[model samples]
Target: MSLRLTLHRPPPGRISLAGIVPNRLAALAMADIERLPLAWGKETPALGEFFRVAGAPGPHLVFEGMDARFCDVARGMAAGECEIHGAAGDFVAADLLGGRVVVRGSVGAFAASGMRGGELHVQGDAGERLGAALPWQAAGMRGGRVIVDGSVGARCGDKMRRGEILVAGDAGDFCAARMVAGTLAVAGRVGAHAGYGMRRGTLLLLLPGAAPALVPTFVETAFAADVFLRLLRRHWLATLDAGGAFARRAGAAEWRARRWLGDLASDGRGEVIHIV
Candidate 1:
């Protein structure tokens, strides 16, 4: 069985479980695991104060009875798998170096901000600023993959530098704003002001609903990018195991994608494609 952390005593305030990882805790006994520090606002509490630790650490770590106030449960993990049974608070998997994170429920704002490498899959909606840059940082999401089965809020992929984000549901306004470079695929309608001031990146709108008008600065390109579409399917989407949102959106053999390049307001290398 995988390692499990059951919430026995929910914290009174937000708890920062930043450095807890299976690799480092594999050999720790219950008492030792309890001794691990958790930042509880102004106070530092032992992990055992909030969680009932059971089973030795392994490749998978499961969190049960999570709530909105449980902030930063798996921040900066470099490896292993984490499964959260309930909703997650803000900044989940912030600056993650590597690993796989799956949240079975909704997540708060700024999830997967500045993640370098890994796969983050969220089964429910993501709040504002999903995959966006941190407050003090200029660039966001250096590398990795993020899949949200439900809608995402405003400014998704804002100022992102690299990686891929797939949103199965709708995306809010200013999506991919100021993006340096990345790939964002949205299966549902995108809100207004999309792709504002993006430098270099690819945003795909595969949903059937109407989207906000493209920014005035982005001039439509007449290039037939059949070759690029094939490449995306063969190289990127094909690697997703064919069961996730990526496969559902781009897997059809007859799918056709149209391309538009712009944010000429910036480098002019960015693109927004509407896939039909």
Candidate 2:
């Protein structure tokens, strides 16, 4: 029996739903859950005051009718599955350690910041810093997988340490800036400054036309890398849906790309591969 929480009225202001993940709800009774405190602006209100709780307690938790006013939807979730039927605010799955979170609509900034492990699927667009580190954090997204079906804002994977972020649509400027280690792939067009100060990581761009302009710091390479391309194709096949745009384009028989390595300012180790 899965538990469901449906918003019954508009919130007074921005609401923080931190620590309301399935792992915590699984141990609480219906009455106990309703009494849980939710951070609303300067006031703390009972969960029941805003949502109409229903269904049985279980590992599968469903949130219905969420909007931008709701933040930290599934922050620090360590286990189980969570589904958001509507749009979610910032930090949708921040610091997720294990489990899966599916958002049917768009999400605000820092969707998966500080994530250690888990899977976050956004059926719609995502805001800035999709899988990047927080302002005060040293490393972002130590491990996990994030799939954004639509476009993403700037600095998508800034300061990312370890993880995979796949975007089916366009990406904003400064994508993967200062990345330490990770794989970030974009199937559509990429904006300026794709990789600014990246130290070590792989940024794969699968655009159809001519490659977008890259910073002068990146130098082109002549390495064929057939074996690596084949392996990457296999990985994409396993990670993305077969019918998705990214998978369809990545399935090309001739997987050719132009590789550029640089961020000479940051050791010149990171690579930017542009599919031809």
Residue range 151-208, candidate 2, lDDT tens digits: 9999999999998998989999999899899899998888899999999998988886
Given candidate 2, what's the lDDT at residue 59? 92
C-alpha-based local distance difference test score of model 1: 0.85
lDDT of 1 by residue, 34-88 (tens): 8998887678889888888887778789999988788786788888999999998
Which 10 successive residues of model 2 have the least lDDT summed? 244-253
Task: State which candidate has the highest lDDT.
Answer: 2
Q: Give TM per candidate.
A: 0.94, 0.96
Using TM-score as the measure, the top candidate is 2
Candidate 1's error at 129, in angstroms?
A: 1.1
Pick out the ten consecutive residues of candidate 1 with the lowest summed lDDT: 249-258
Error of 2 at 107 (Å): 0.3
TM-score of 1: 0.94
